[model samples]
Structures are given as C-alpha cells and as structure tokens.
Target chain A: MKIFVCVKPVPDTAAKIKVGGGASIDPAGVKFVLGPYDSRAASKAIALRDAAGDGSEVVAVAAGNPNKGESEARKRIKDVLALGADRGILIPDESYENRDPLAVAKALAAAIKNEGEFDLVFTGRQAVDDQAFSVGPMLATLLGVPCVTDVVGLEVDGKTATVKRAAEGRVEVLSVNLPCVITAQRDLAEEQYPKLKEILKANKKKIDTFSFEWPAPAYRVTELSPPPEPAAGKIVGEGPDAVPELVRLLREEAKALSF
Target chain B: MSEFRGVDFFLLDELLTDEELAMREAVRTFVDREFIDNRAIEEHHRAGTFPRDLPQKLGELGVLGPTLPDEYGCLGASSVAYGLMMQELERGDSGLRSFASVQGSLCMYPIYTFGSEEQKRHYLPKMARGELVACFGLTEPDHGSDPGGMETKAVRDGDGWVLNGSKMWITNGGIADIAIVWAKTEEDIRGFIVPTDAPGFSAPSIEGKFSLRASVTSELILQDVRVGPEALLPHSGGLKSPLMCLTQARYGIVWGVIGSMMAVFDEALRYTGSRTQFDRPLSSFQLVQRKLVMMHSELTKAQLIALRLGRLKDEGKMKHYHVSFGKRNNCKAAREVAKLGRELLGANGVCDEYQVMRHLMNIESVYTYEGTNEIHTLALGAHLTGHAAFRG
Candidate 1:
C-alpha cells in the first residue's frame, strides 16, 4: 500500500513574527518549520505503512519550494522525509507560497493524480496561516474522493475508513472510503515523539522535487491585513464580588450568559 | 546543582520551525537503531574503545556535523535540532557522544571558525562525511581543568611552526586522522589543525580509565612536530579560542545530561515498580517515591532550562554565562540523578547489565571534564560578584 501525506513548511509557531515593510511575510529573519499537525498526520500515515510490512511505502509531499537550499521551509520538508517517508514530492515554485487553499490543493491533487495510485491521503487539519482548515476538503473535492476533516482517530478496514473528529462538545465519528483525504486535528495522536533511532535514520528517507502546471486560480486575495488585535482585559471586581460582577458583565455588557 | 541554563542559540528559532518535529522524529529513530540494539557498547566499555565504523554510520544518518553551514558539508540545520541530536546520542553513552562532540564542536567548529581558507577547504568536507576522525587537544597532563595553564608551545619555523606539547585525556584520540591542537605560541595561544601523520606527532591511548570507558582516551605527544603555516588556525587567538570550544561542548551536554538522567530515572522507576522488597513494590516505599519525585522534578525543570536556553540560542541572544549555568547545573543534576538511580537499584544497579552503574560512572567524567562543577560554580559566583575566585 502507498500512503501520502500533505505537509507544509510554515513559520515556527514558537518564533515571534514581526511584519516587514511590505505585504509579504518577511522570511528574512523568520525560522522555517514543518507544520506541527501535519507532522502528526504524517506520523500516523507512516505508522500504518510500517504496520503493514516491507511492501508499504510512505511518500511525503509538500506545497512549497520543497527542496531548495537556504529555504528553511524546504529544509523542514527534507527533515520530514528523513523521518521515514519513503519518497518526497516537493512542488518547486515560489508562486505556491501563501497561495489560496484551492491553488495549493490543486497542486497536490495533480501530483497525486500523476503518482497514479495511493491507498490513503493524510494532511493537517489546518495550516498555521489563517487556520483555514480547508485544504483536505478542497483536495478531496478535486480528487473526487471522500474526505474526513479534523480527524483525531483513524482505522482502516478493506476499502472503508473509520475516522474520529473532535467536535464542539463530542467526538463525531465518520466512515469514509479508501483513497480518501484526512485532515489530522491537533487533538489527534501526538505528531512528535521521535524515538532516538528514528531521528538518526530519517536521513535515508527520499525527497523528490517537482514543478508542474498549476495555472492561475479563480480565487485571489484582494488584501493581506493583520487580524484585529484583541482588546485589553480588566478585572471588574475583587474576590466574591468579582464572580457576581463577571456574571453581570456577561449577561449585560458582553451578553454571553452561559448560565 | 542548580537548574540548567543551556546554550545560546539566539538564531535557531527561524531555522527550526518547519522541520522541528520531523527532524526530532528522524533523530529519535536513528538513536533507536544505533544505541538500543548496539552490541558494541558493553564490549566497548570493556575494551576501552568505540567501534571503528560507528562514526560513519552516524554520518550516513546526517548527524555527524549537522547545524554546520552547508559549505563545510554540514546539514546547516536548526541549532535546536542539533542539540536534540546531541541529547539522543548521549542517552546511549557519553563515550559515543564524546566522539560526536569532538567531531562537531571541538574539531569541526574550530576549523569552521578559525582555520585558514586552505585548511577549511581541505579538512571540513571529509570530517562531515566521517571519512576522517578528529580530536581536540586542549587539556594537558597537568592541565585538565585549567587549559589556560597549558605548557604546550608552538615556535615559529622557517615557513611553518614546530609544536612541543603533550595533551591529556583527549577523547576520540588514538585513531583520529587529525587533531585540533591548541598550543600557546610565544605571543598568544593559537589553534592548529595538526595531521596525525605529521612526523614527531603521536597519540598514545590513555590506559586505566574508570569512566567513559566506552570512549577512547589518549595522551597527545608533540615533540617539535613540524607543521605548515596553513596548519595554524588563523582566526584563533588567546585562551578564548579553546574556551569557546568548551562552551559549545558544555552547551550540548546541558541537554544531553537530561536525556541520560531521564533514562536512568526511567530504568530505576521501572525496576522499583517490579522488584518486590518487604512484600511490596520498591516504588511503594516513601524514600523511593521521594527519589522518583526529585528525579522527575529535576528532569522537568532541567528540561525547561535547556529548552529556554535553546530558544535563546535560536533567537541569537544566548550568553556564555547562561550556558555555564546550564552546564554546571545539568551535569551536577545528572550525577545526582544517576546516584539516586543506582541507590534505588541497590546491588543490582552496580552491574553492567543494569546500566545504572555505567551512567553513574559516566556522569563522574562528565562532571570533571568540560569545566568541572567547582569551576562552573566559581565562574557563576564571579559573574554574580565582580571577583575572580581561582587562586594558585
């Protein structure tokens, strides 16, 4: 069985980012990173392949300049490839950087189509940027296969897959078909618990770069603006009075009365 | 010992984000294959030398000199990733790690930093590929802790330098193809990339070692060893050059000590849970619980210190004092944890098969080398108060 995971190189969430002079995300000082959730999804996919034995292969693909030197993004993708992905598919084009989900999804779908056959597709529930959580669904639609978004647990039997998604208050379980897309949620199995030996062997994992036709997409961002900064918070009252005051503010001022 | 302060990788954050999780997984995998099932470790300790081809295996895994700028055939990876790799390597044994430390920080770092253009072009690529074994010569027979007091001298020849000195307790010695020897010239201390094949230069393996037996220890003898001008590291000057190398090694140890301590603690924890004493699991005892709690708390806090320091290193604001603290604290804590682990195991812990005694013995050398616990404390004390405490 052939497994594929859609990984994206993003800004390390731990690193603080400052806006540069232009609309562009200033990568000059930014630390490049593999998306955390995508690592988890990829781990899950690799685990499945390993469980099935030597005939299985885990192919890792990314939606950025996947194998360019000096690009931290590409370096991260390579690191992931080393993590046990049998082969890597890096789409080499700066145009894909910060592109719309539809554009990135199209690039991935085309690669999947080119590969001809795959039993499973895995991806993070959402990329760090904007937290759109749209790529898995978009890719599934483009590939004309079933998709399980925000999946936290997965089980495959024959051509069917039982996926568990973390919902608002409860876990929503859904069964899908083989060759389906899964957006791994953060609540899912941990993405990084690298056993020592695996880290050393990840170097052998193959990473391949590709540049295929993506053509212009219908969707384009009119503007790139920062999300409004959250307003400052202040305590209304102290001690027991604060609780009652918080209730009053929730009921009257903010009108978010959970009680 | 205090909490670990860790390395100052003030520039690693941006570089590590994308591959942090992935690289971590990869390294963990490599460690599992190399260390866990390694048949050579116990034999290595008994034989007193690491496996000859182990370095090549690590190089193939992309771990030998990662984080080095790619020009030198390094991975040019995130500093945190490098630290993580070091930590995992050490979990197996300090002897194994000493090889990497010498290769990466002690040997490769100096060449990358101070070697002449010709030296860098000649030595670095092969070292990264593990085709060449490298050793750092700083500590002398009389100068293990006080490297500045080294009596090694390099006198100028017609177009070269002739070195006269003997370095002591050198790790990865004996078989190193090259050595980064720090010698005090007439005017200043300088680093030299001395080839092992150089006439008058010989490395005799140090015998009768109690700790780090799985690693090679050697005494480097340089009797008027003639070297070309290209051999002298042009950028290295004064006592600071070798001190900087120690800082890098110490920084790596801060994280690595935690890994070893965790392993000892984990083994002890597992053993206590299974061993029945006085009709109860050893873990049921209050004393055992306290030890476990201390080990856990120390491990967590040490981890945080190293992690925070690692962040600083990633950010490009890390300082030597911070690393000094981390080295001092983490090494001391590891020794304590290892001892506690041994105590928890009773007589069984002292045996090789148990592995606690190995760690316990290993931590002793770790404490003494790379700036001893006393040295670090005094350094920190001097930092806190503008005073130099060392006296003849």
Candidate 2:
C-alpha cells in the first residue's frame, strides 16, 4: 500500500521564538522540531500498516530545505524512519522563507498527487508555529476526499475506515471510505519508544527524492507581529487572606472570575 | 549561538535526512503513550520490583539497543538521534533510561565493539529485541575510583576459565539474563559475557539504596564460575576497554542530565508564578528572577554542549577528554541547578510529590557514577600536562 504522510517543519513549539528587531521571525537562534501533531499522524500510519502484518512500505513526504538549519524537518524524517517507515521524500523548497500557508499546502497537495497514487493520507490537525489549521483540510479538498479532524482512533478495513473523535466531552464515531485523510491530534495514540534496533534500521532505509514544479502562491502573508507578552500581575495579601484578594483581582482586574 | 560555534551541533537538516526522523518519531510516540504515562513506573519504584513487562513494552516499540546497527534489529539512527531518544526516555524517568543504557551502552556495546563475531551473533539480536536483559559489571565495592585494584580474577581451567569476583552497583543485575563482567587476568584487565544461569553465579539485589532506587542495582558474585574461551571478549586489553564503555554511557548522561534539569527548571518556573508571597506571585521578586535565569542559562549551556558533542560523536571525531569534559561539567552544573531549583520551590521542593528533591538526589549518583567528577578532572589534567595522573 502506498501511504503518504504530509508534515511541515516548524520551530519547536516550546522554543522561545524571537521576533527580530525588524519584526521578522528570527532564524539565527531558533531550533526546529517536527510538529508534534504531525508526528502522531506519521506514527499512526506506520502502526496501522505494521499491524497489517509487515511488508508494507510507509512513505513520509515533507517540503523543506535541508541546508538552512531548520534541521527540524530532516530530524522529523529521521524520526519517522527510525520508527519503521520505509522511506522519506524530502522536497526542498527554496521559497519557504516567505511561503504562505495555504499556498504551501496547495503545492504539497499538487506535488504528492502528481508523483504517485496513495491509498490513504495522514496529517497533523495543525502545525504549532502558525497554528493555521488549514493544510490537512485544504489538502483533502484538493484530493476530493473526506477528512476527519482530531482523530483519536482509526481502523481501516479494506475500503472503509472507522474513526473516533472526541468532542464536547464525548467520543464521536465516524466511518469514511478509502483514500480519506486523517488530521491527527496529540491525544490520538501514544508514540512508540525507539529501540536500538530500529534506530539502526532507519539509517539503512532508502530515502529517495524528486523535484517537481511547486505550485504558485494561492495565499500570501501581508504582515507578522508577535503576540503581546502577558504582563506580570502582583499578588495581594498573604496566606489565607490571599485567596480572597486573588478572587477580587480576578473579578475586578482580569475580569475572568465566575462569581 | 556563540557558545556553540565550532562545535558540530546535530544539524538535522544536512545530517539526519528524512528517513531518520520518521523512525525517531515512531519511538517518541510510543514512549509518550505507553511508558511516560504509565502509573506502573511509580508503582514499581515504590514496590522495588523490576519493571516486569518493560522489556516487552520496549520490544513492542522496537527501541531496546536501538543504535546497535540494523542487522541486529537496531534502528541504526545517527548518534544524535540515539542521544535524543535517551533525552526523551530520561524525561519520563531516569530509571527507565538507565534500563536501556545498561542494556545498550554498557552491555551490548562491549560485545559489539570487543566480542568475537560468534558472540555478537549469539547475543546481539535477542538482546536487541528485548528478549534478554543484560547487565554490565565494572564497579566493585572496594575499587570504584581505582578499578586497577579490582580483586576479581579469572584463571584458566583447562578448556574453560574459572572466574572469581564480586561486582556491585550493577544496573539490571538481579534480573539480567546475561552479564558482561569486567575482571582481570594476571597480565591485564578483560571482559567476559557470562550467562546468569551459569553455575556458581549469583546476583543479589542491593537493597536500601537512596539513589536509583527505582532501578535495580545488584551485587554479582562469581565463585568458580566457568566459561568457555569464546565467552571472553577477544578485543579487550588494559583499562581502556571497560573505560570505553564508561565513555559511551557518560555521553548519554550529558543528555539525560538536561532532561532532568528541564523538568526541575520548568516546574520551578511554573510554581513561582502561581505561588503567593509578599504582595505578589513569588516570581515577581527580583531574587527569584535571578534564580530562574541562572538555572535557565546553566541548562542551556549544558544542552548546547551535549548537542555539540553528539555531532562530534556522529562524525567519529569525539575524543575521550572532550566527552569527559562534557560529562563532568554538565553533571556538576546540573547538580548546582537542582539545588537552586529546590531552594526556589521553598517548602514544596523537598517533597517527592513535587519532584525537585528527587532530581537533586539522583544528581548525586550521576555525579559519582560512570567515573567521579574528580576522575574526569584528572583525566583532563593528564591531557593538559602530557602526563597520566592515575598514579600521581
């Protein structure tokens, strides 16, 4: 089966992203890691095929340049391979510096659809950096397939899939047919621990690449600004009296109080 | 960034390629789901039981002995990837990572690096699959700092050898299926792989340990334990052989220490913000801010050093002294950071429920084990002075 995993490389969500003096995302000191949600998607795809009893080749395809030190993308690729994915397709994008999210998603969709056929597609619900939450749905629209967002459970049987999604404090079940895309969230499945054996196998797996025409821009970023840092607030009173004072501040100052 | 210049940090872009990340991601997902959240870890830590099914869980994840080369069921990810895996595991629990380190770095490494091909074939794959738990023994009660004074001796007994020695502080010792023990012959130090079921072999649990209590540390006594010539590690000679394994394990420590420090640092940072003090959150104080920044900078420096060393290790340019420097320096820095982190937590810090004191206790063992900080300093001094300092 040809399984495709589409992932985006973003600066580690936990990193202190510095907006430069020019208000641009600073590339100098930032470290990139695989989008955590996308990693869950890739992990699930690999697990699904493996449970089908081996001999399945899982391909993780991502768009990124390996030279600019966003090294997170390649590292993510290595992570997938180390977890038992058969191969990785790294499509380098020279235009990623200022690429728009929707445009980037469109380019990935076109490139993947053009190169080969896929039985199913997997993606994270959202990339942590931009939190655009647009790519997976957009890609599914491009492919003319149904997508279930925030999938916590998935089981594929021939041409149909049974999926579970948690919403409003309840588990919602949905059934979709073959070739559907899944946008996985963090709570989906537990990530596997890498053993020494698989880590070694990842080094030997074949990584093949092909360059294709990157689709022209379908969206553009007009501006970027840092979110305002939360201001430090003072604590009033001490010990037991502090609780009532905190409640007073929450009610009167921050206005987040319930009663 | 300047702190790490000229040091090859694991440049994921040009180095790891795409395939490696896929593999590592799989492992990370499994750990996060199965082990990190496993309440059983705390249960076992409390009950003093070996993580009974941890080997199976590891086998399911396919990560035990992960970087040992692909033919042996290893992932063969670059040293950097392996280091990251250690970081992730240590974040869950230091004991869990210790399980893998003893099995991989201390046990499997000696066999792979120094054993005969037959020995590797006989043990590597099973060990990799987590079918067998292996332990390494080098430290003895009387001679941790000076392994040269080790009293354990192996004597030739016709077609086989009779070994007599006692090894202590051995990780996975009591339950290990196989043990890679370092002992001395009349001429030099050597390594041997002895099956735990071998006659005259006994591994007794070392109880009442204040550190690494979650992980099993055992005492191994060999009374006329016999092994065929093939059991001997053919490549081992002098003190460098066992020390080489220490070199590998300590590099893992450089990363593992950071994982612990991050936990404490992150916790302390979060606590101060929520904690109330004089007319403000404890974090509002200038002194607290200073403590936080100091902890953060120390952790960051240690992280960069570990990452850079990981790259050098991948490039095969890592020197013994450089590794020692990272281990000694990072371990010392982490110990200091743990102390400050606990102090910043005030009354809640020392309690295990809050966990900073646990880190502080663990750092003491990390500082002394693998080779004490003083030992590393002496090793570094030897390089600087163009002289060996073991005797001096």
Candidate 3:
C-alpha cells in the first residue's frame, strides 16, 4: 500500500501573535510547528504503512512558499519524514497564506495526481490556524474519490477500510473502498516522537519540490484584530448585605438574569 | 514555565548549522515536555528521587555519548551539537546533565578510548541504548582533586585481579550496572570494568543532599572484589587516563552550567516583567534593570566561551587548561546569574513554584563537581605562570 499524508505549518499555539500591517500576522519572532491534527494524521499514515509491510510506502506532502529562507512547509514535511514517512513532496506557493481552503485543496489534488495513484490520502480534519474544515472534502471531490472526515479510528483489510467517527455523543462506523481520503481527528492515533536515529535518517530522505500556478482566492481577509479584553469584575458591596445588591445588579443593571 | 525562546543575544543561532539547531531543538522539546511542563523535575527534587525512566528516553534521543562513533549506536554528533545537548539538559536540571556526563564522558569515553575492541563491542551499544547503566569511580573517600593519591589497589591473582577500596561522591553509583573504576596496581594506576554485582562490591546511596536533590550520589565499596583479566582496560596506564576522562566531562560542564544560567535568567526576566510594584512592574526600576542586564551580559559571555571551546575541541585545538578556563568562568557566572534571579523573584524565588531557587541551589553542586571552581582556577594559574600551586 502507498499512502500520502498532508501537513501544514502553523504558528506554535503558545506563540504570542501580533497582527502585522495589513491583514496578515507578523512572521517575525513567531515559531512554526507541524499542525497538531496534521501530526496525528501523519502518525496514522505511518502506522498503516508499517502494517502493510513489504513494498509499502508513506509519502508526506505540504504546500507553502519556499522563496523564504528555510521554508516552514518544507521543514514540516521533513518532520513527518523523520517520523517514518518514506519520502516527501513540497508544493511552493508564494501566496499560500492568502489561499482559501478550496485553493489549497486544488493544489494538493494536482500534486497528488501528478505523483500517480495512491492507495489512500490522509489529512487533518482542519488546520488549527484557519479552522476551515473544508480542505479534505474539497480535495476528495477534486480526485473524485470517497472521503470520510473527522475519523477517530481506522482499520484496513485488503481493499476496504472501516472508519470510526464521533457524532452527537455516539460513534458512527462507516466502510469505504480503496483510494479514499481520510481526515483524521484527535483520536485517530497517538502522536509519535521520532527517535534520533530516525531523525538522522530523515536528513537523507528525498523531498521533491514543485511549483504550482495557484487559483485566485475565493475570499480575502479584510482586517484582523485581537479579541476584546474581558471587562473587570464589579464590586457592588461587601458581606451578606451585598448579596441583595448583587442580585439586583445582575437582574436590573447587567440584565444577566431572567428572574 | 512558558516555552523557552532561547537566550541568544549574539545571534549565535545564525552561526549554528541546521543539523546542530535541530539537535538542540529536539533536546529542548524533550526537556520541556518530559521534565518542565509536567513538573517532573520539581516533583523528583522534592521527593529526592531520580527519574529512573529518563535514561531510556534520553538514550532514544541519541544523546548518550552522542559524540561517539555511530558504529557504537551513538549519534556521532559534532562537539558543538553535544554541547548544545548538555546545555538543554542542564536547562531542565543540573542533575540531569550530570547523569549524562557521568554515563557518557566519564564511563563510555574511557571505555572507548582504552578498552579492547571486544569491550567496546560488548558495552558501548547497550550503554548507548540505556539498557546498561554505568558509573565512574575515581573520587574516593580520601582523595578528590588529587585523584593520584587514590588508595584503591588491584592485586594480580592467577588469571584475574582482586580489588579493594571505596569510592565516594559517585553519581549513579547506587543503581549502576557496571562501574569504570580506576585503581592502583604494582605497575601503575589502571581502569577496571567492575560489575556492581560482584560478590563483595556494594554501592550505598548517600542521603541528605541539599543540592542536586533530584540526583543520586553514593559511595562504592569494593571489598576484595575479583574480576577476570578481560575486565582490565588494556590501554589505560596511569592517572592520565582518568584525567583524560575528566577533561571530557569538564568540557561538558562548561556548556551545562550555561543552561542553568539561561534557565534562571529567563525566569528572572519573566518574573520581574510582570511583578508589579509602586504602580509599575519591578522591571521598571533601575536597580532591577541593572540586575537583569548583568545576568544577561554574563550569560552571553559564558555562551560565547562554551561555543569557542566546543569549536576548539572539534578542531583538535583544545587543551585541558582551556577546558579549565571555560569550566571555571562559566560555573561562577552561572552561580551569579542564579543568585540575581533569586533576588529578582523576591520571596517567590525561595519557593519551588519558581525555578530560580532550584537552579540557584543546583549551581552550587555544579560549581564544585568535576573539579571545583578553585581547582580550575589553580589549573589555569599553573598554565599561565608556569608554576603548579596545587601542592604546598
């Protein structure tokens, strides 16, 4: 079995983000990491490939600008390779940050098609930075294959795959044939921390780079601003005598209570 | 603790190769996830227990004797890369770095440099994988800085040797599977690979340590312990062999203490920036600002020295005295940085909730071990003045 896992480089969740001039985030001082969901997707793909045994291969794919010194997308692809992916493919797009979910899907579909047939393609349910949750379905539609999003568990036997996903506090299991797209949820697999030997071997793995003619964005981010700071707590009074006043303030002035 | 952004005032990151940076980042991430974020360092320190599981994890990361040849299951990392690993490990705790130093430089290094090929084949891979833990036994109850005065003796028996002596202040001594012991023979001082389970060998843990509490320090007793002739490190001839191992460890200490400084400096910076006083953050005061500046300045200088020494070591240009200079200066600088950090944090600094006090206490052990600050100072003095002050 040959598998492909898609990944994205997003700002580390702990980074203090600042909006740059115009509608973009400042790239300066921000550390980029492999998106958490994408990491899970990569782990699942590697595990599947390992189970498949002889002649099985796992390829990691990503798309972003490469002109910038040490492209983050390329680094994220290398990270997956270190986690046991056989090889990698990077699609360079100078304006990737501005691309919508559909645009990214189109680029990934084109890259996959150009690489020939694959047994399966894995992706995160959504990119943490955008939270769009549309790219997997869009890519499957472009490839004309069935897709299952938010998959928490998976088992493959021969040409068929059984997928488990959570819905309304219940798990829904579905079966899909070969050549399908799977968007991984958090429970898809446990994260893998690559051992140093794997990390060193990854430096020798092949990562083919390509350029794509990106489609015009479907929409634009007009402006970006931080969420408003919460208001400070008000002290209406003190002790037991303040209880009636607090109730009155909540019910009348703040209009927070219906009673 | 928030993520460590690395304190590189000199843009040293630009000077490092991508591979070196990646190695450092891997260790940094491991330290954060395994030790810092989970509060394992603090918990283990308070409980006065070693994190026994750490060795396997660190070995998997390929940091154990990382600079050794890859043929022995090691990473064959550059000198600078190994230094970076030490720096990151010590950033978590001095005990952690000390564990690595003892396992790698003191034990595996001597084995690789002096042991027979069979010995390397038998021990290096298992040690690299952390399946076999090893300790160094050079410092004895009667001698530390003057290891030449060691009284441990090995007597030649028909096909083996009988050893009798006691070693003190041994890191990992209590739990080590094997010990690389330096002993005096009729001919000269030699290294013997002694199994800890030898009939008469005993390693008892020393209690009541106020510093490096997360680490284990023990006394090793070899009472007429007998070993086969094969156990001797064939190439080890005299005190110089053990001193060579000490050189390797001291080189790592030069880098390790810098990590302690980074931890404390970063903590102090974060604490003073947010701590409000007199209608403003404590960082606003000139006094506090000066303290921060001094810490940062000293930390940066120490970093430069470590990097230079690492490069020299890689280039085969480093001397034992060079390592002494680096070890002496960096350890003292780190101690001062930790002190300022504690002062900056005020009462909170004394609490384990803040890392400053922990680092402050750990630096004392770091300052004294692998040759104390005063010993190194004298070593450098002898190097500069062409006179040995080590003797009266």
Candidate 4:
C-alpha cells in the first residue's frame, strides 16, 4: 500500500498574529508548526501503513512558497516523515501561499501524480490558519477519486474502507473502495511524537522538490479587520424587584424569552 | 505547551546545519511533551518516584548515546546533535538529563571504548535500546574528587576476580541491571562489568534527596562479589580510563546546565512581564530589569560557550581542560542565573508552581558533581601554570 499525507506549515496557534498592510498576516516573531489537523492525518497514514506491514510506503508531501525559505516548510514535512513516513515531496512555488484553495488542490494533485500511484491520500479536515477546508475535497475531485470529509474513524481491509463521520450531531458510517481521499478529524488517531532516531533519519531522507503552474485565485482579500469586541454585560435592577426587569429585558429587549 | 523563549542572540541557528536544526526541534518537541509537564514532574518529585519504564521510552527515542555509531542502534549523529538533545532534556529537568548522561556517557561509553569486541556486541545494542539498564560506579564512599584513593579492590581468583567495596552517590544505582564497577587490582585500577544481580551485589536507593528530586540516586555495595574473566573491560588500564568517561559526562553537563539556565530565564521573563506590582508590571521596575538583563546576558554567554565546545568536540579538537573551562564556567553561571530567576519570581519563586526553585536546587548538585568547581578551577590553574598545585 502506498499512503500519502499532505501537510501544511502554519503559524503556531500560540503566536500573536498581526494583520499587516494589504491584509497579510505578519510573520515576524511567529513560530511555524505542522498544521494540527494535518498532524492527525499524517499520524493516521503512518498507522495504517504500519498496520499493513510489509511493502507499505508512506510519502509525505507539502505545497508551499519557495522564496520564504522552504526549510521551515520542509521542516514541517520532515516532521511527518519523522513520525514514520518513508519519503517526502515538496512542491515549492511562491504562489501556493495565500492562493486559492483550488490552486493548492490542483498543485497537490499534480505532485501526487508525479510521485507515481498511491492507494490512498490523507489530508487534514482544515488548516487551522485559514479554516478554508476546501483543499482535500477539491484535490479528490481533481484526482477523480471518492472523497470522505471529517473522518472521525476509519478501517481499511484490502480494497475497501469503512469510515465513520459526524453528521448532524450524529454518527454516520460509509464504506468506500480503494484509491480514495480522507480528510482526517481529530478522532482519527492521536499524533505520535517523533523519536530521536526517526528525527535523525528524517534529515537524511532527501525530499524531492517540484514546481507546478498555479491557477488564478478564485478570490482576493480586499481588507482585514479584527473581530468586533464583545459588549459589556448590563446588570438589571437589584434584588427581587429586579426579577420583573430581567424578565422584561429578556422578553422585550433581548427577545430571549417569549412568555 | 507554551512557546519556548529560545535566547539565540548570536544568530546561532544560522551556524547550525539544517539537519542539526531538525534534530534540535524534534528533541525539543519530545521534551516539551514528556518532561516539561510541570504538574506531572512535581507530582513525581513530591512522591519521590521516577516515572516507571522511562529508560525504555528514552531508548525508543534513541537518546542513549546518540552520538555512537549506527551499528549499536544509536543515531550515529554529530556531537552537536547529541549536545542539543542534552540541552533540551536538561531544560525539562537536570535529573532527566543526568539519567541519560549516565546511561550514555558513563555506562555505554566505557563499554564501547574499552570492552572487548564480543562485549560491545553483547551490551551496546541492548543498552541503546534500553533493554538493559546500567550504572557507572567510580565514586566511592571514601573517594569523590579523588578516585585514585578509592578503597574498592578486586583480587585475582582461579580464573576470575573477587571484588569487595561500596560505591555511593551512584545515579541509577538502585534500578540498574548492570554496573560498570571501577576497582583496584594488584597491577592497576580496572573497570569490571558486574551484574547487579550477582550474589553479593546490592543497590539501595538513597532516600530524601532535596536535589534531583525527579531522578533516582543510589548506593551500590559489593561484598565478595565474584565475576568471570570476561567481565573485565579489556582496554581500561588505570584511573585515566574512568576519568575519560567523566570527561564525556562533563562535556554533556556543560551543555545540559545551559538548558536549565535557559528554562529559568524564560520563566523569569514571562513572570516579570505578567506579574504586576504597584499597579505596574514588575518588568517596569529598574531593579527587576537589571536582574533580568543579568540573567539574559549570562545565559547568552553560556550558550555560546557550550555551542563552541560542542563544535570543537565534533571536530575532535576538544581538550579535557576545554571541558573543564566550559563545565566550571557554565555551572557557576547557571547557579547565578537560577538564583536571579528565583529572586525575580519573589514569593512565587520558592513554590513548585514557578519551578525555578527546582532548577535552583538541581543546579547546586550539578555544580558539585562531575568534578566540583574548585577542582575544575585548579585544573585550569595547573594548565596555565606549569606547577602541580595539588602536591602542596
């Protein structure tokens, strides 16, 4: 089995993100980490490969800008490899950053094609930085494979896969055939922290780099603004006399109560 | 986990190779997950218990003598990579680093360097995988700074040796399955690989240690312990052999203490900024700023010294005195930095919640062990002045 996981290097969630001019996020003082959801995806891919035992290959790939120094991005990809991926592929093109999710999907699809055939492809449900959640589905569509989104549980047997996902606050199960796409949710598997030997070997594994022609972004950002600040809470009158006022406020001013 | 405030004022990351950075990052991630959990560490400390099966976990990580060759199940990585691992481990806690340092520099190093080919094949791989735990027994109840005067002796028997002595202040002593016991013979001092399960060998855990609370320290006793000829470390001839092992451990200490310094420095930085005094952040005060600045400078200087020493060690040009200089200077600086960090935390400093107090106590042990500061200073003094100062 050839398992593929797509990883993204995003600003660490703890970093203080600043909106620069032209609505771009400031990179200064921001520590970059492998996307959290992507980590789960990578972990799942490695687990499945390990479960399959002999002749299983896990290839970790990332599509990102080359000019910003691909080492940081490459480090994120290496992180997955250190977790047990067999090889790595990096598609380094400047346009990949802040581009359309469709462009990223297409580029990732091309890179996957360039790496020969893979029986399965795994991606995060969404990158925490953008929450776009479009890349995996779009990539699956481009590759003409069956796609499953927000997969909370997955089991693969030979040519078929049984998956469970959350649907309308309920559990939903679906079975799909081989050569399919999976966007992993947190419940897929707990990410394994890479150990020292794997980390050392990850440095020795050569990451094959490639570039893809990016499509025009479907949309562009006009401006950026911080979210609206929350309003201060107002106290209704004082003691038992306040009950009627609170009820009136809830029923009239807030409209939280009908009676 | 909070983002670590890595004080790399010298742009040192640029000096490291891409692989070195990757290695450092991975170790940092592991440390953050495993040892840096203050709540768990404090719990273990309060109970005076080491995390069970820690050696196996560390073995899986390949942190045991990572600089050794790949054939032994080690990483075969550069010395700098090994130093970074030590740095990150000590940043989590000094006791944690000491556990690894003993396993690698003390136990495995001598075996790899002095044991026969058959012995190396038998022990190195298993030790690296942490399948077998071991401890080094060089310091004795009578001899610490001066191991030449050690009272332990191994007398020749029919085709083997009978050893009788006691070793104190041995890290990992209680739980170790194998002990590299250095004892005097009629010809010379030699290292013997004695199984802790041998008939007369006993290791008892030393209780009530205020320092290295997160780690295990023990006393090893040997009463007429007999061992076969194969038990001897072939290439080890005299006191110089064990001192070489100490050099390896001391080199690691130079790097390890810097990690403790970095951790406390980062804590102080965060605490001062967030803690308010007189309606203003404590960081706003000039005196607080002075202390922080002092710690920051000392930590920065120590990091440079350790990194340079690491590079030199990788290059095979590092001298014993070089290690002494680094170990002595960095340990002293780390002690001062931890103190400044504690003072900056004020009342909260002494509490386990802040954790600076733990590093403060641990650094005191680091200062005394692996050749005390005075011993190292005298070594440096002897090197500069062609006089043997100890003779007087």
In terms of TM-score, the best-performing candidate is: 4
lDDT to native, each model: 0.78, 0.77, 0.91, 0.88
For residue B291, give model 1's deviation from the true position in Å: 0.8
Better of 1 and 3 by lDDT: 3
Distance (Å) between predicted and true CA of A183, model 3? Answer: 2.5
Locate the minimum summed-lDDT window of 10 residues in model 1 chain B: B1-10
Model 1, runs deviating above 4 Å: A1-80, A83-259, B1-18
- Tens digits of per-residue lDDT, candidate 4, A1-259, equal 9999998888888778887486568777777888888999998898899899999989988887767854566888888888879989888767655587888889889999887877899999999988899999999999999999999999999899999986544779999998999999988898578877887778778789877877778886667776677889989889999999899988788878756
- Tens-place lDDT per residue, model 1, B260-363, is 78678878888999999999999999999999888877776777778788888878888888998999999988998999999999999988877688888998
- What is the C-alpha lDDT profile of model 4 across B1-392, one tens digit per residue? 75676788888877887677777777777777776654667777667788777788789888898899988778898888888888888898888899999999999999999999899889999999888989999999889988899999999999999999999999999889899999999999999999999999999999989899888899999999999999999999999999999999999999898889999999999999999889999999999999999998998898898889999999999999999999999999999999999999999999988779999999989999999999999899989997767656
Candidate 4, CAPRI quality class derived from DockQ: medium
Output the better candidate (1/2) by DockQ: 2
lDDT per residue for candidate 2 within A1-259, as digits (tens), equals 6678888778865467877365247776565666778778888988888877755668877877657654455556766776668888777777776666676667667767875677788889988887888888888888888888999999888889899986654689998987888899877777554544556567667766646567676666666778887879786878997898789888777778645
Q: Chain A alone, model 4, TM-score? A: 0.87
Residue-wise lDDT of candidate 1 within A1-259, one digit each (tens)? 7888888877767555666355556666555667878888887887788877878888887766534545554565565665567777877766665477888888899888898988899888887955878888999999998888888898878678888987654789887889889888876665444432344455556666667777776666555556689889977978886898789888777868634
Between prediction 2 and prediction 4, the one with superior TM-score is 4
Highest lDDT, which number?
Answer: 3
Candidate 3 chain A, poorest ten consecutive residues by summed lDDT: A191-200
DockQ for all candidate structures vs. native: 0.09, 0.32, 0.48, 0.65
Candidate rank order under TM-score: 4, 3, 2, 1
